[model samples]
Target chain A: MKKLINDADDYVDEMLDGMVAAHPDAVRRLPETKVLVRSDAPVEGTVGVVSGGGSGHEPTHAGYLGEGMLDGAAAGEVFTSPTGDELAEMVRACDGGEGVLCVVKNYEGDVMNFDTAAEMAEIQGDVAVEQVVVNDDVAVEDSTYTSGRRGVCGTILVHKCAGAKAAEGADLDEVKRVAEKTIENVATMGTALTSCVTPAKGEPTFDLGEDELELGIGIHGEPGVERTGMLSADEVADRLTAAVLDDLEPSGEVATVVNGMGGTPLSELYIVQRRLSELLDEEGLDVAEAMVGDYMTSLDMRGCSITVLDLDDELRELLGRPAHTPALTV
Target chain B: MKKLINDADDYVDEMLDGMVAAHPDAVRRLPETKVLVRSDAPVEGTVGVVSGGGSGHEPTHAGYLGEGMLDGAAAGEVFTSPTGDELAEMVRACDGGEGVLCVVKNYEGDVMNFDTAAEMAEIQGDVAVEQVVVNDDVAVEDSTYTSGRRGVCGTILVHKCAGAKAAEGADLDEVKRVAEKTIENVATMGTALTSCVTPAKGEPTFDLGEDELELGIGIHGEPGVERTGMLSADEVADRLTAAVLDDLEPSGEVATVVNGMGGTPLSELYIVQRRLSELLDEEGLDVAEAMVGDYMTSLDMRGCSITVLDLDDELRELLGRPAHTPALTV
Candidate 1:
């Protein structure tokens, strides 16, 4: 209820307007739509990559729109899915000569909407479109908004790898292949110390005891696998990393992400990262890369997630490629 | 008390360890000190830029250390200034033949400690050093930790400008001049919806009722100019922007920053930016640059700050120069 916002109804639109204003040279809004695209989108012969979901998890789909990441992103209201029509608009806007690829999370709403958009693009505009669904959250098999496993922070890795491949002049099929591969290798688990409040609701989506935390929490404030007493930073990191490692059983080199759930401080994320690095070393896994920040988040939720990607040589090389986006640059 | 930390004593060290581990290619720690230096420090014939303060402000002094920003940073305990000895060590590590420039925020402890460090380096190591104190916060004339005025988010602008100038091979005096110019032109004001808790204290630094907010709150939870009922995001933005404009009276092109305290969501920051952009337009000021993020922060305070800098051609061009750091890149 103490959020910094004008009106609940205008939250998403105002955020999008602000994003365009802040990074005019890098991104812009599609006319009369809630879709944001790279400033110089629809490159003549390059594969155009796109992604989107709800609005609260910022720097995810929209902030990733730039030269080396997403070509366009259709934003929905907070914790809601974008309309299929808006998504179809994004597909058309991003479809260059090389075709378009949609990188979507594994939520039921997102998958259905993106699928419908792809069909619309193909039937209405003669645009070639492919889809890759990310279901990397190993915490739950079914959730409030998802049918299978939920997609969490690991989606950012998919965006990074697939975007890099597309920027390398790969075709839509190649980009889709890389994105799927990333989904196959990545795993994530999260815990929430506090619940998130949607702008429209103006109250916490869930109630958590002051001394308790929800493990395996979803980004949209869905119930997690366990509700337990609060633990130390090291204990939380261990629980999350162990869940991911047990799920993926990654070998050789891996990429680790300690993503904050909106309201956590960067200092705390680093603390989590330190323990994660130690755990990885103990498991005899070499870290290929490490990212610690609020890459994807629930709106003002005080929590953190750990994501691990088993990186092959190709994925590692692709992740290292230069990317220029509003929230991420490499 | 629901923070992701192991022990209060190890908070700063663990965070620093994690930072270095996550960004090994860009930053490293000095032996036996809480000082982080660029991977390639003391670039010969380049004026070294050094800054530091309490440990809670992640990506401030430490995150800014890189190719074109800070050469080194000395970190203190949570909400405490770094010791003169450690800061002296930082000066020694960063000093090249062209001398070093110390960019100190205008907190009493930080200013005094940095001044002592500069003197120590000049006397013991025979290194030339210059210091620029930033007191751009227009909230009050004096505060709990400062005398003249507090330095808030505007200090980041000083780092960007002076760092770019030094990277251009400017000498100590030149870098000092540019940093001083930035300090003179920039102004900032902040408000907090909730209080920040230091790791050691494990309690809120200050308290606020559910319906109230503190206007012009200091970064370290110092008392602000006024405490009032919570306002809408647009109203908050209008008040903050009006205060900054009144103090700065900036004309022509201006650079603005909407900085979030540690716990605010990016969506809210963008909302604030949207209103600020409109206010700037109404004032007939051209926005030369806009940054919206958690640039400088209190530990986990849910609030935001607004900073505006009147940019001349020199500062504007320097702001555009290429710089690579952990938290910021341009």
Candidate 2:
């Protein structure tokens, strides 16, 4: 449990403080809630986009709150879902004249909370809210935190495409439609070389043999479909891509995201991308865009995920649209 | 050691392959050398900025080769210096008619290699080459790989400032001057909770007890100034700041970079920045800019280094100048 933290009880609040201080122009916390909104919120014509799950996967929901990405986020504690009330407050904070779109991952707690928040936002009368549940992880049918396939790195693409649609003056339903479309097209699979320690737990969420890798592991230390012996970068890439390919029939061009699960070196992420791109090339799918970095992460977990978005022209436009978030700027 | 790599011999080459594939629009590698130049290098009227040392530090040299950063970089094997021939080839590849400025870190191999390259370039052609050796580590006066303090994370700032100067149509002398100025103004100190394993060695570089941390560790897994019981993030901030402040008397607005040594979680890095900012605030130094990410890294070390730059107006403008590199985009 060697972590750089002050108090476990105040970890989320303190992290938010540090984040706001670090990127003051990019994000700001609503006065009393765990909701972080874009510093200049309620951009008059754009539909507000909000997303959240837990705190450990940083630069996710909160770091995406900026001009061309998320408008706000409800950050729960590490690996815990934000309350529906917290999410509803977030929807209200950044709702301009247009409505709000909620991007919820497929985790059970997150789905339930965002669903309740959408109803609450509609009931409150000012903000019309729609939700899109992302289930892009082709890893498992069910997991510790999720009911269906777990949403992993592909959710960042959902946020990007949906936010781009909203920024293009799309209304609530249109933004929701684009988000759902992104969810349908994107698929991801990951392996974990090590588990992460949650601040509250003060211990690693899971353990593994030194040379083993848990393939298709969930973000919150959920069991993967297989626990296997160590594999080379090529073998790891083959396995993860095989799982994803079995789930998705790809053609034409695709956008690839080789996401680091916290503790993996960027060099290794690039290594993974090398092998992953080779696989894509063999499949005759042109790599439209490749994002290789730590877009989302568990707390110091050593692993990575590969996400491919089977793209069409419209989705390509949205995916390639300029985004100026703290984490992903183009 | 658990790592995603193919042949250790091909580690640097494969990483660069993935890098160029991912950022074809920003950078391209020369076929004959490990030199990564801007996709459209030798910008007609601008001075070329070149920096390189090791390859394990992804996004340091190669990732900085784009519109407003390095014009070229020679990629060496992990934790090893690029050969003088490799670096000279890079200078030749990106040497616009104006000149080239080589930014060398203060490691023995790196300084010697870059010096040799600069001389080789001068002897071969009309390309004027100037060098600025960065030694901003306030750690040891001398270490395993250096005659003086090892230039660690502060070297990234030198790249940013120097590259920005070069992009602004500065001549070789001006770019070299700004880089030298940055070298004098920056100070850094680091601590390691765990050391990294170089791929070639196939073992951890160093080891520590469960509750120990090495203060002021070098990027090449060299031991820091001291080893002590692990401290809280607040205590760690105080100790690191105290050491750096003793060496650098920062006045006016300052730029701070809390760089992860590859494996520290962004959450914990923020926890570190929270306390670090508090310390700087207490010392009456305004934080003009703060970068919190793994800008420079040791393979997969689980620790961080804090860099502080005492800024005046010229340095401030250079620091703020737009950079469109694959890693640092503004």
Candidate 3:
């Protein structure tokens, strides 16, 4: 196993320090609970938003917490969801006057832990709590087998919609509604050009040949829907877009996102976007907005995903709103 | 050479298609220019924001274009800058009534290409253009030598600040002022635990022996200032943060960012952030905000970086304002 660092044990703690060193304006550490928060948090009467998941997806939870977004984000070890206790601590830190909204991606560990936190928050005080599960990946046809569809890249969409509402001083219920509405309009499907290796594991998450790609890959290097020989850019676009469009049934207007898994490039995303516009035009869907980038990524996984969200005027306006965080801005 | 791609020739186009298939709302392709834009675009009286870089940094340029950020983005081939012609086409499509502001990472190739586009736009008529070159990486002593610093994760800071100003209806000069102010205040330094392998180049970008890391690495996989034996996470954070502090001179209040090189997990980033805050506290500096995640990355390179931005009220308010895009929110 090849790796770097004097000791693996202190990796998480040390990295957290570096993060604070980098962005003092956006985050602060809770010494007692090890939770991270926006530096000037508990913003008066604002409802707090808290989220967390496995740590490998950087910028997902903590990085997303700030004004107009999450107030606090708890992180677990790499690829491991936070425990209920940890989340409970974060809930305590983030609970403001109105309530607290938990934006959880629909992963088993995440849901369970966040659910526990919600319950704990209720037991602790008058803190109102609500949980919104983001299950936007359309690749998984049925949620029956595995606690519903895995929340893929589309979780970012949920964050924006809910975060915007929260920023506007919406109550927790309204925020939850916005989050749910975003989820309903959104659908996602992704492919993997290659496998990502975990440093601790010291091996590739999955294996693939040079001429092959995995369709419908999960973020944690899990098996995608299919491993097939390579296809043309247009063909792949057709398949992925068809799946999302079918799921959304987006009429009038929609938002499109072309996401790069860790290793692809902007050039490739543009090429894919070209084909995507044509397909949407052919379908007579008015493209209200489009974003192509590595918004949500699986570390070093080469490939891209397409996500479409059917939007009404309100959603469109919200999507156009300005936001600030480490990785994105409008 | 091991790779997951079928053929080199078709990789970019295929990847693009895959991205579009995944995101219909955030992106649309202008076939004529091979550029990607937000589905809700050509908004009246808004300054068009455009950015592009080499292809390997997926979503850095294209994924960021949409809604409140960029009007259009041009993607170059993997690790290569786009031609001026391509950029000009993007400019033409994205330029709204207000004007156009180009946010460029400081790279020779990128600078040349975007500068060419600016010149071309001037030739085209009725387009006001201004650019801000991001030079936030503290690794290089200067920006004019073969061994000069290469722009790394710090480019994201440029995007947020500049994009926010553009979104707020700042004129071309104001956008430039905001971008330049961020560039002056922000500084970044990175370390890589392991090197990454690019498909175009079958071998890894560089080799690091087991238990080693390269500090002050460039985003394009350029050599860093030092390659040393692996150190503790605190030591790693110290090296990176010290470099940034030395460059930015964080006196009163500061903002921080701990970014992964794609492969590092949130667990690691959190650890780094924790230590960084302690370090800053020891230094007697007031931390305004902090962010931890994978903002900018070098493929799946296993490493982390620290960015410190000495802030004033304007920068802070700009940072705090509501903004939205695919990956981040304010």
Candidate 4:
């Protein structure tokens, strides 16, 4: 039950307050709503890109808000989906008049909630809204949170790629096309060394033996493919990489994002990166870009995930586009 | 004692290899030396600013290697100092014909090692090497790692400020002065909810009781002021802020970095920032800039630190200058 929080109910709000205090120039909160909008939202003629999901996953949606990234994010409670009303607020706030694109994770709650927001936007008129549901996790489909494959760190790539397209003045349909392309090309799989604690739960969401680990772990501390005896760092990387590459065979030049679930150190992430690079080299897939850090995280979950974005020329150009947000800038 | 590492001895090398692989465009490994240099080092006229210590503090010395950051960083063994030979190699590799300034943390091993490197650089006769030892941690004057206050996260600010000055074409002496000024103005204090593990040491560096914490903990997982029962998050923030602010007596406006000790989640850090912003407001100090995340970390320690830099116009301008490194970009 050890956590640095005031109360379970106010955790998301207070966290957002702290975020606003830290980056007032970058993001702002909609009054009384758990939606964070880029301060420069509705940029004249550019399509709006909005993404969001549960809280706890730091820097996922909101942390990707900025010039070449998401225009806004509707935040849910820790591991819970955002409400439909908040999604509607986020959509309206981010709409730049050309159109708005919602990048939803594959979780059922998120898909349902954002669909409601899109319906509301269509009902209200004036602005068009499009939605793309990312289901990149090769680890699980039909999890506790979703009816299909759970979206994981690859969603960050979707935000970056789609947001880059949106910033290029692409309409809602174009942005949605690029986003769906990303969803089709990216695959992710993770392994957890330890469980995480959501504020509401105030305890470890799951438990394992001292020398055990869960492979193909989901971000919300859900059960993974299996709990097995701990493997060496290289073995773990090989397993995760095999799972992801099997799902999406990346060739030519690919972009890799080795993401750390909260609580893992950067050194370990680099170790994972080392093994991944060797594997990619052996497979003859040139790595165009490799991002190794905490882009998406379960709240203090000690683990790591490898996301490989099978890159063609357009995807490479979009991923390389310059962007600035609180946690990510590339 | 679960950690994602192979052979303990290969940890630093593999980690550095991974870093280079992930950021080949940004950093490179000098052959046979435990040094990572900017890919475009020895810029011919700009002063070379180099910093280093033990290896586990990621994004510390190496992460700051880029356009407006350190020209190079010497990597030592895990939680151990780099050899004088490695530091010397770093200075020579970064020299650029103008001069090189070594930014050393205030630790006995680091100080002695860099002192040796400075002597060697002076004797070998080409690069005029000047050094500024950062001793900004206000917790204790002498502790496990040094005869002076152990440099903690505040050292990152020194790299940032000095690196900016160096990038602006400041001479070696001028960059050293700004670095020293950063040391004079910045103060930091940290608390540990859990100790860290060095790859060299196969187990936790220190032990803490359940619901217990240690205030004023050092970066090396050394003992802190005393072990005490866990307090509310706000209470923890109040004490850490008081310690740093009392040491600094910062007025007007201040820049802050609430750094995670690697294992704490961003939500917890935001909670700490929530209370810290309140404290600064009450004390009549405007926060000019606030960075909340893991910048410098001890392996996988679960804790946090607050660094407050009292800024004047020049320091503020220098700190705000654009810089691009692996972990930090501003």
- What are the per-model DockQ values? 0.84, 0.77, 0.28, 0.79
For the second chain, the TM-scores of the candidates in order are: 0.99, 0.98, 0.93, 0.98
| CA lDDT, candidate 2, residue A258 | 91
CA shift of B201, model 3, Å: 4.1
- After superposition, the stretches of candidate 1 with alpha carbons farther than 4 Å from their true spots are none
lDDT of 3 by residue, B134-249 (tens): 77788886544223456666677777777778887878788888888988888898888877666577677888898778988877777687999887777888888888888777
lDDT of 1 by residue, A197-276 (tens): 89888888889998999999999988689999989999999999999999999999999999999999999999999999
Question: Which of 2 and 3 is ahead in TM-score?
Answer: 2
Model 4 agreement with the true structure over A159-199: per-residue lDDT tens digits:
99998998888887888899999999999999999898888
Worst 10 residues of 2 chain A by lDDT: A139-148
DockQ-based class of model 1: high
Which CAPRI quality tier does the interface of model 4 achieve? medium
DockQ of 2: 0.77
The candidate, 1 or 3, that scores higher on DockQ is: 1
How high is each candidate's interface RMSD, in Å?
0.8, 1.0, 5.5, 1.0
TM-score of each: 0.99, 0.98, 0.72, 0.98
**Higher-ranked by lDDT: 2 or 4:** 4
The segments of candidate 2 whose C-alpha lies over 4 angstroms from its true place after superposition are none
Residue range with the least summed lDDT across 10 consecutive positions in model 4 chain B: B197-206
